[model samples]
Target: MEMQVWASLFGVILGGLLSYLAQFTTVRLAARNEEKRQAAQRAEARRSERLELLREFIAITQAGIRIAEERDQAPDWDAAGTPEWFAAARNIIDRLWVAERMIEVLFSPQMYQLARAYASAVDHVLWRLPEQIAAEGSMWDHLRGPQHEFLAGARTDVGSLP
Candidate 1:
């Protein structure tokens, strides 16, 4: 009877120890999985935000290009300070400003440098041709390569359109 009691106690202690170990392992795995899941979620959120910013930046750049094109094609655009001409000029400037700010806010440092280079190209054209319009053909040509590289690197759907 004493031997039987000893055997039962041994079995009970072993069972308790096994149960505790199993529970501990399960809790540890669960915590690890939760951490991994949260990390993935944060990475996804950052990717989404970056995509949105890229879209906005590209859209603003496109708008600025279109405005410049329209101004180039306009008749009597040489008549500086005329209401219509002034409005187009203002629109182009405003859109470029917005693009610059977008790059500043959304771009990584290296990306910002590349984008700023593009913007600087545009600025140079604008400064040189303050009163002229279609003269920016060279500027657009210069931007095409860098713009394509930027878009490709970013993996964004925004295309580099002249």
Candidate 2:
């Protein structure tokens, strides 16, 4: 009778140990899974931010291209600087300023450089349109090569990232 009582007590103790170990393992696994979930969420947020920034960059760059192409229409930039020209330039400059600020915060150095190249191409058009057109008869024709190059480089940069 005493042996039977001892066996039952041992069995109870073993069952309790087993229960404790199972709970401990389950808690650790749950914590690990939570950490993974949080990390994945952070990564996704950063990716969305990068995509949004790139989209804004593309928008501003395309607007600048359109402006450059439009300037190609006027006989001279002196003649082109009408109210409409100033208004369009103002709008584009404002948006470009915002994009540049975002780039400074979010982009890698190479990405920023690509953006700067595109912006500089636009500035070149804005500053030298009259002279370029006066000399070459079609300003955009000359600028198009560099503009395309900058834009393509930027696109490649964006595509290469995961």
Best by lDDT: 2
Give every collision pair in model 1.
none
Please provide, for model 1 over 1-162, each residue's C-alpha lDDT reduced to its tens digit, 9 standing for 90 to 100: 999999999999999999999999999999999999999898778667767777766776665555555555556545533676557656766766676677667656667776666665555544446444344455578568767776665554223211
C-alpha displacement of 162 in model 2, angstroms?
4.3
Give lDDT for model 1: 0.65
Could you tell me how far off, in angstroms, the CA of residue 98 lies in candidate 2 after the best superposition? 2.0
Which parts of model 1 have CA positions greater than 4 angstroms off? 80-107, 123-137, 156-162
- Encode model 2's per-residue lDDT on 1-162: one tens digit a residue: 999999999999999999999999999999999999999898779878888887887788778767867776666656777888878887897788679668867767766776676666666666564556578766566567766775686677667655
Residues forming the 10-long window of minimal summed lDDT in candidate 1: 153-162
Q: In TM-score terms, which candidate is top?
A: 2
TM-score of predicted structure 1: 0.72
TM-score of 2: 0.78
Query: Local distance difference test, per candidate?
Result: 0.65, 0.75
